[model samples]
Target: MHVTKEQIAGMGKFERANFINSLSGMKSANLIGTKSEHGVTNLALVSSVFHVGANPPLVGMLMRPHTVVRDTLQNIKDSGVYTINHVNEAMVEQAHQCSARYDSDKSEFEATGLEEQYFNDFAAPFVAQSNIKFAVEVREIQVLQLNQTELVIGEIVGVLSNKDYCLEDGYVDIQAAGSIAVSSLDSYHRTERIDRYSYAKPDEPLRSIWKTQS
Candidate 1:
């Protein structure tokens, strides 16, 4: 199973892509919702969401190069707002179908049987089926010249989640929320609560703070 850089370059497109993407292991599966100025809604499944900073609560996601119409990116540029919704076990099928290149006028929420939700004055829609969702304001977009991929960074402005998913110490119980993760590009998996440990200090033994469910 050893693959060198030369071997990787020689591999077929699909094979090379799948292998490289899967090497990153599991990633958070999220549905990014946006709306055009004319009110057309778009939902796309993304797995590259990652934490950028916490002081200002920033999150970043990578969007594939614009080989075709990029409704989500365009909408965000036009409106400056979007929603990130976690995909759970029950929403896997619908969430995956979002990757299909539907007409820009078509709404994935309606096309895939997921309900659209709105809160406060957010300009984008949210997946009602998701237990954990948040709204963000577009902060910056950086285009990588090497690959032409776009890095979208947003500042989290609001959050909505099931009451049961919040812990007393301000942590989220993602496993209890039923959120799922993605491997490579297509495989979906349910996650389990392993263990949470306290911050490490010099001369102190690492300790687990996680509690087993009664």
Candidate 2:
């Protein structure tokens, strides 16, 4: 159970990748959709999506090293637009398949049987089967010097979802949408709504928002 830095570096490539990925615990599972400048669409599953800021509604995602060609990253950079679609229970299989390596000309949407959807003037496509989806415009790309991996930061421009999943307080009910999360690299998980807690304040006892309504 005790793994040292040297031990981690000495581990096999696949083993190290899985171990390092799982160490981050459960992460948001999303399908990143992009389109090449030549109009070829691509879909890829990514779990590294994270919130950067609320005021600007910025989101960040990590991409593997650019030593080799990366279609998704290239498309996003070329088009300056991408879509993040939450991978729900029903689309788990298809979404996971997107992680497989494919030729640059091959579209994961077509390879995995997922439907492509678009809205407004966005240049990227969205997963039609996803219950919750949002489109973003690329703002910046930062490269990690230690590793060649790149970090892409984008600003969310539009979000689409079923009205039933939206709460009075503007919170989207992810559980109602049946969205799923990922553990490690390949495991899929379903989540449940625990309890909604009231905003914390100094010198105040913690309380449940659900209890107040009941």
Candidate 3:
């Protein structure tokens, strides 16, 4: 149970990777959709997507080292637009299959049987089965000096979600949207909201906000 840096380094490659990845616990599972300038669409399953800021509505995700062929990263760089679609429970199998390595000419949408959707003439494709999805425009990309991994930061240009899941105060009930979470690289899980709390004040007791939401 006690694992040190030296111990981790001594572990098998696959074992270390799995252990380190799962240490972060459950992560948002999303399908990043992009299209090459040549019109070849690509879909990649990633768990690294995260919120960068709320005021400017920025989002970010980390791309593995670019030493090998990375179609999604390349397409985003070439086109500057991409779609992030939540992987709902129903689409887990199809979404996970997108992680498979495919040739540049191959479209994961076609290979996985997931329907591609477009909106407002956006160049990137979205997953038709996803209940919640959004389009992003690349704002910046930085290559981390330590590991050569790339950090992609983008602005959310538009969002598409079911109205039923959108709360009065602007909180999107992802659980109600049937979105699933991922652990490590392959495991998938559904989530339930235990309760919601109001913003904490110095000495004030936190109040349950879930009961007050319309």
Ranking by lDDT: 3, 1, 2
Q: TM-scores of the models, in the given order? A: 0.96, 0.94, 0.97
Top-scoring candidate (TM-score): 3
Local distance difference test values of all predictions, in order: 0.91, 0.90, 0.92
lDDT of 3 by residue, 14-37 (tens): 999899999999999999999998
Local accuracy of candidate 1 as per-residue lDDT tens digits, 1-214: 7889999999999999899999999999999999998889889999999999998999999997563239999999999999999999999999999998899899898899999999988889999999999999999999999998999999999999977788888888887898999999899999876788888999999878886332
Question: Residues 59-159, candidate 2, lDDT per residue (tens digit)?
Answer: 99999855222899999888999999999999899999899888888889999999999898888999999999999999999999998899999999999
Candidate 3 wrongly placed segments (more than 4 Å): 67-69
When summed lDDT is taken over every stretch of 10 residues in candidate 1, the lowest stretch is 205-214
Looking at candidate 1, what is the lDDT of residue 125? 96
Ten residues in a row with the worst lDDT in model 3? Answer: 64-73
After superposition, candidate 1 runs with Cα above 4 Å error: 67-69, 212-214
Q: List the candidates ranked by TM-score, beginning with the highest.
A: 3, 1, 2
Q: Between which residue pairs do clashes occur in model 1?
A: none
Residue 74, candidate 3: Cα error in Å is 0.7
Each candidate: RMSD to true structure? 1.6, 1.8, 1.2
